[model samples]
Target chain A: MSSCEFESLEKCLESHLPEAELTEVKHILFGKETKKLDLPSCALEAASERDFELKGYRFEAVQEQLRQPRRIRVGLIQHRIVLPTDAPILDQINAMHTRVGEIVEVAAMCGVNVVCFQETWTMPFAFCTREKEPWTEFAESAEEGNTTRFCQELAKKYNMVVVSPILEREELHGTLWNTAVVISNSGNVLGKSRKTHIPRIGDFNESTYYMEGNTGHTVFQTQFGKIAVNICYGRHHPLNWFMYSMNGAEIIFNPSATVGALSEPMWPIEARNAAIANHCFTCAINRVGTEHFKSEFTSGDGKKAHHDFGHFYGSSYVAAPDGSRTPGLSRTRDGLLVVEMDLNLNRQISDKWSFKMTGRYAEYAEELTKAVRHDFKPNIMKE
Target chain B: MSSCEFESLEKCLESHLPEAELTEVKHILFGKETKKLDLPSCALEAASERDFELKGYRFEAVQEQLRQPRRIRVGLIQHRIVLPTDAPILDQINAMHTRVGEIVEVAAMCGVNVVCFQETWTMPFAFCTREKEPWTEFAESAEEGNTTRFCQELAKKYNMVVVSPILEREELHGTLWNTAVVISNSGNVLGKSRKTHIPRIGDFNESTYYMEGNTGHTVFQTQFGKIAVNICYGRHHPLNWFMYSMNGAEIIFNPSATVGALSEPMWPIEARNAAIANHCFTCAINRVGTEHFKSEFTSGDGKKAHHDFGHFYGSSYVAAPDGSRTPGLSRTRDGLLVVEMDLNLNRQISDKWSFKMTGRYAEYAEELTKAVRHDFKPNIMKE
Candidate 1:
């Protein structure tokens, strides 16, 4: 078989003991009483037939007489590219559209009001191969992009807000950017926010394709709630998450495409820490499986040249404001994690933690201003 | 038995299944091949006789041809108050000094170049009581206080740097503050940095005693390495950690005294996350056992009044820049964790992660300057 058609799923998706052990351990952030929600047989059958994984969980706050619960169902979908990496761009996009459509249909059946897909869901994570020829061909307009149009259709059909992370090609400046388009439940494009941080380390030659985003931290006010997106590398910056929370975001989505070798250890940490720090619901979604590139690439480290970006290791999960979280999905399979969260918990945790009241932002502002100056010297107490 | 004299270790130290289960689970941040270090038998005997826990772990980095490894042994001590809350102030101070002296001796024997004690190590955590009589009497001069003098002697004896967090009574203004005094290996006081953030919620009536710290982020450049102290509530603020890192801290110590009901879940997360973000080694030290006050107090929550401040769970551990960590000490017992870390690993991981190169500090400085304004508006996009 040709390299494009040669599926080395076994070699790429090797399950080490640590990963299995981590999967079995229940984090203290999750409650002991947390149980799985029963889904319809048709949804289960769809996942079973397509060989994808489906997980559902519910988080409840203590009953309060002060406010009615603002419960919403959030759906996070992490999936593999439908076709081989060497396929035609349009054909690959179409195949991915079909795969995501099936998952969103299952989410709709489960009463999801808001759904989000992995980073650049319509294309394979080809940034590792850094060749600008066919990879840049995948960039399209954010407003009229084929991916956004498809997501808008699904959003209106299910009356769900869809957050679609994509590679955007600006027509005027001829510049490309990593962006997330937020389509409201009415199928109107609410807004788009680009990835705040572009990673340059490892096999992630993302800077070769796009630079830092220009659009500031934006919270999309939807029928479901105030949501924001911290696409991919933005997850590494706590300030990115803090700025969104400061903007009144109740839920933040982190659509990421990271391999297991470079980021698996940090996968469960950054987003969950953000949820705790910001007092908001955070959904972390990553694409599954490995995609072999047509050309070999080197990661700059003194290692053998390779054709793949290592395994994506999809283990998407949801973390709550109180630090509680749902168990993650499969590390080796495409999966959908449906989380039922009470928005009241956000305020409850905020009141309990009171990090906002005592944050001392003014002091940090003054310090940061001084720190950014050209003549800046660190506050190091030396001998 | 009187509540003050009663050491209900069995009842207050009860280990639920989840806590035990969490203890058993080896976090993915720690390497699988990490093994225990062989310490002098006298130190082990001291711990065995005193019934406190002692754990030692070593972390190594890949040998580089360019530079010799900068290896340093760090000791973190977490212990219960040596006497009853109602005991005379000087007597209690002496008792705590004796207890910590024993631990420091053991640490010195283990070749610990730098050793740190838990927050307010010389006194009971009496902020919950909010009674200003004997509790406030524990406050002393950060420079010449008995606690500082004691720690200075220890530093001189072992030729080790000592970090002692204490409640300070500033002589000039007669104002009190929570401070960490850094003592040089030569038994001289280098400097002091106060707690950046003061918590107002929960049973902590700390504001009634002391306000926020005035000293900026201070990194003490010792004979061993540059270190900073992010005392207690400062752990919750990511900016505090960032500033310390920006000041070029190699190791940041978070000496905290917090109870289980309000903060047990967050204990393992904040410092570890800071270590990952800042590319430094973080040593988290929390005191053990429950301290019952002489008088009852009510946390602003609508619960009944209580005489104790819940259990101060002691799960002290060390987190490296690469996200690998050592197993934490026991939750129920007084403990010391000695970590042998190669300081060169900090630069190596920083080179690998490249967060500093990509971090847009100037952009954030401008954003924060605007954010702290009176008429500042969050960059929120609405419908």
Candidate 2:
């Protein structure tokens, strides 16, 4: 494959695959892990391969001194997109795959320990159309999906934990899911979390395509950090975040595809709230810019059919356990935000908040059991 | 009794009470409900017995017209104090009682239908001192406490729903609770909700004072609105908010006594997040200024004994169901924030966000059942 010759992520993939027999190849990496201290540390950056492009990038570091250091450098990539309106589904997938790989390479070069992408990063947010013809073809298997395979190679090559969010297994029928594929630094397919809360409002008629997730809140204990993915609309659910926090997630990524008018006001709130309440680092990622389709569709409102789903303002930011946040990325620009801080901040913050120990989880669980009763009796009164 | 000598709401009370045996007295209001065709209209302000103070006041009207307007004006009052440290318990109680009554007058004059005072709004936040003797004397009955009677009179006087959060029923045995007394607009004692989440960290050793709530999340269908109070520390628990929302709380008041350094950062987050998630208007009230105690105590740290907790930082604000927020009250001054908007905004925002309809509650209920299981396994992978 020729290096540095491609204009987009799709062209980068064409050099690696002949298109017909791509499944015969498995993901493998040749780059060595730059040996450094295994624990989260401020001095964890090591350059095993000195590429000139990579050498110039410096990580945006949080200067919080830790009482007991467990540092992890996390990266979140928010990409603006441009795809020809008439492009085939395969070409679109190839473009996304190549773009994400490039972003991961940049994150790895900046010595990011773990990286996460936005929700359904491979394709445009097409549910607004509600006409489910070609969009269904974008769904692939999590274990051997083209997106997963592409990420696995990058994960192994960079020795970085990768969270690849994609639409999964939908084309065949009755098995579609919005999933986040968690890959270990060594290219092992660790686990996947499905989008638990499917939004069914306005342009987000996601329930038409995907049901609620069957996979419960799963925290992957990767080599870099213990992470969980609360996919897209799941960001609205505090219980979704609480369950992950209960399962001992040090970091939770909310990869969302929300636009300005539908959810912009709510964007800055939910994930940061989850971070503070759960005492964990939270990464909120959104796709940037506008994606217009060749076909226009009706919103059932009798208004003129529109091609775009509004702007997916990609103001991605990471919130620390202490309720501090890194500056948000630009709304209209494609950018990668790297946040370096001590993971032990979780321990300190949790110790201060003491929510896990003080919270009446068992009691709440009991009430919830009663609340879900078939003949629900509300404990409410009126004069 | 000279009627004009009494203050705004207090004078309205004198007309009903006659300064006689008030227990035998059934409250008769001199005011009438000026009903406007509801769908949250700013023109709903109709005064029956208009004092100059009340006539001059108007609700902070939102211009958003409603399809089916169910309008209600909510008020949150935050107060500051420098109670004489050497004063007797009754003196402190009287001091707080008089101060809050004045604030209630302002709220009533503003035509606020529901008013919530800050957490334990009566006395100094003496819990930080950790001294058992004097503070224990402050706890009173949820039903017939001195504070309840004071609020009950005010509630009937102005036909205002009153939520009075207080240190309750602790002078005797183990019956102590951090509770909010809900007074119906008709002066009926609505059911109370104890603080569900008791914090147990640093200076907030509240578990030492009160156990978790047993009343459950109770919503009262008041004459003005369906309301619930999430007392102080319970604000940290989203499930508490969720349960209330499930029970159809249109407006949830979070009366809190949180100080600056310990929880000021979280103040803006928790209630606002709840408002968005639950599709309900949320009122977050906090005590203002610093209150000093006569005695000094250790925080269990090696530091010397301290005379006061940190600043209360009264930044009480109202968050709309649409994720918009009322500007917060001053951090260092006593202030009352009046939020007047359409109650049907909940219906509109919920229709837009549809988190209630689209969110997979039952699915989550089933999963949470297993999640709280003793033998639950985390979906995690490790090397």
Candidate 3:
């Protein structure tokens, strides 16, 4: 066939070649006949180069290249505390300072730009079975408390963001607040967020000890990244994570003081979901070990004594934006977990997946937040 | 008092009471001298009522009750395919007597189980990309073909199980296999799940013509309690919605086709992580979407294509042990997804707070898997 005619015929075949015919054409073209086809010098040269072609059409190539530089190293200190409820309150506070300082030092050595400790890290879990004495002494002033100053100095020394949870002492009413403090690398106290939702279920009698946090969901701008904290029990509320992320928190930390029996299994899935849904990185640090205490007061459920000396199984971890987890640290041992991460990976995965971009957030907010009457039901079939 | 007795009294006061003052106790007890001292009687009565006293002599009551039971619903289905890849061969074989009949008539209605359809429910997805002419003919058997028979029958008769993806044969080898059949209660296929992960990174060149599935990860089991399907590509890797239980999932269906991402995503997380990590019901069905096309093919990546299509995303689901869905009909759409479930609030929320059972598995398995390797030097920590 003439060259021009051959080109037209090749295009025609390319457009309509059946599966069986394409196989035959491939056999014939790549067979001995490939040598016999006479060609224009330029066309022959081009054909000799390596490019994938079928009939006369070449396939297009697509490549995804990284656009930004994003790197971050994260460390989680999964601490275990067996607070002696009967032990003197001052002793308990001193023990926390010593133990937490050791972990902070270790995290600093690991080159972590930020280190997170579990909720209420400085006190024993006093909410499960509220005791009046523990509550009275456990509450500490946020600005001038010994724990806050100690952590601030550590942050200054290590040049890392230090997140510590304590029983925050409210000035006006003398009540306590379950609070998390985010300290900057320069020893400046960036901000503090109090626990919003107080749980009254199971042994979690939080309301008796502290009122809900007054500050709304807030994200702090830090040198490393915009960060936020969602204390224990707050993780269940999706809106909490959403609000913080929408305000531009690149990394959200959930530092919790909980045992394996109450929430360990949910750990692997929940934090990761938050990261994926919010398009942010998540670090969940949990306390391991058990605490035994005696209840000082009687309650409606009529529990005189509470002993959570059960294992605290510390499975601390970091969830990437794409829902993959870095290798989780141990729940058995008292140790430090460090992970090197790229801050850009969150943007890259979000750009490709487009969950938030494509999500119908406005509509959901309007529809979901409205009060559903007793008789209301969603019509799934309505197109 | 004697010196020995005085010293013993001093030690007792120092050890038992740290912050309490003797004056406060004496003032509180002085007025009760007129009343009879009945300490033993009070102690007996308190003990009988399950009340225990703390070190400070504060009375507290304890309630001992058996843990609540936890239950979840699950569903499963298995069906067959009728259309072979070769058209003339199919012409010789009557479609009425094929396996599709048993799926629509028996499996959909009488068996009425969690109706799982065979992979590539309509026409096979493997034909068009391969260089085979006769196989192209099989592509014409989609909507008006045997699939309609199953869809209509199950939609009307047994609307229990949610039917999975049903292939739709459009034209000659122009059919699409990565499709889902979501049948609602009124006997209509509500939506579809197009395969998202199209295997292109390996020997399987699934990108020749049929594009990758475009649907995002979504949950369908709504008030029916949350449930979702991670089709072939959806199963390849873990993503946000793949194993996420927003409220919670009674069942998760992973209908897969391939063995690796060329079918890998299909086999790995489809059954294992989708179930264990998520703590939901899960089922993995492989079509057994396998095909033997008589065509040699060139992959988009310049490799010789052997067998074009591996297997199909089969119909399988993982569900909570309880056969109950959150809240919906247990009817079959096309490929059945029937599950009998108890939707009691107690059963849904009765599990221990922290998936303790699930955490134990990760702990024991961590040694065997060695998922996190610590071989790399500390790049960021070095001065």
Cα lDDT, model 2, residue B68: 47
Residue-level lDDT of model 2, residues A44-132, one tens digit each, is 23212211111121112234554545667888888765476458888877877766666666676567888899898888888888868
TM-score of each: 0.92, 0.82, 0.60
Spell out the clash pairs found in candidate 1.
none
Name the top DockQ candidate: 1
After superposing candidate 3 on the true structure, give the runs of residues whose Cα lies further than 4 Å from its correct spot: A1-68, A173-175, A211-216, A237-243, A276-279, A296-306, A369-377, A380-383, B1-74, B78-120, B123-146, B154-164, B167-317, B321-340, B345-383
Docking quality class, candidate 2: acceptable
- lDDT of each model, Cα atoms only? 0.83, 0.71, 0.50
Every candidate's DockQ is 0.36, 0.23, 0.02
* iRMSD of prediction 1: 7.6
Model 3, span A53-141: residue lDDT tens: 10111111123374445555666776655347677877878887877676666556556688788888877776766556655687888
* lDDT accuracy of residue B236 in candidate 3: 35
Candidate 1, which segments miss by more than 4 Å at Cα? A1-35, A63-66, B1-35
Identify the leading candidate in terms of lDDT: 1
The TM-score measured for candidate 2 stands at 0.82
Residues B1-383 of candidate 3: C-alpha lDDT, one tens digit per residue: 21111211112323433233422221111111111112344333432342211011111112225533222223343333345455554442345234443433433322233454544544455533544344334332334555544565655665544555644454664545556666554555555555555544323444443565544434455324455565654543433332234324445566655431222221322244344334455556555334555565554456566655443333233323211111111111123233433333323333422232212222212221221123412111101
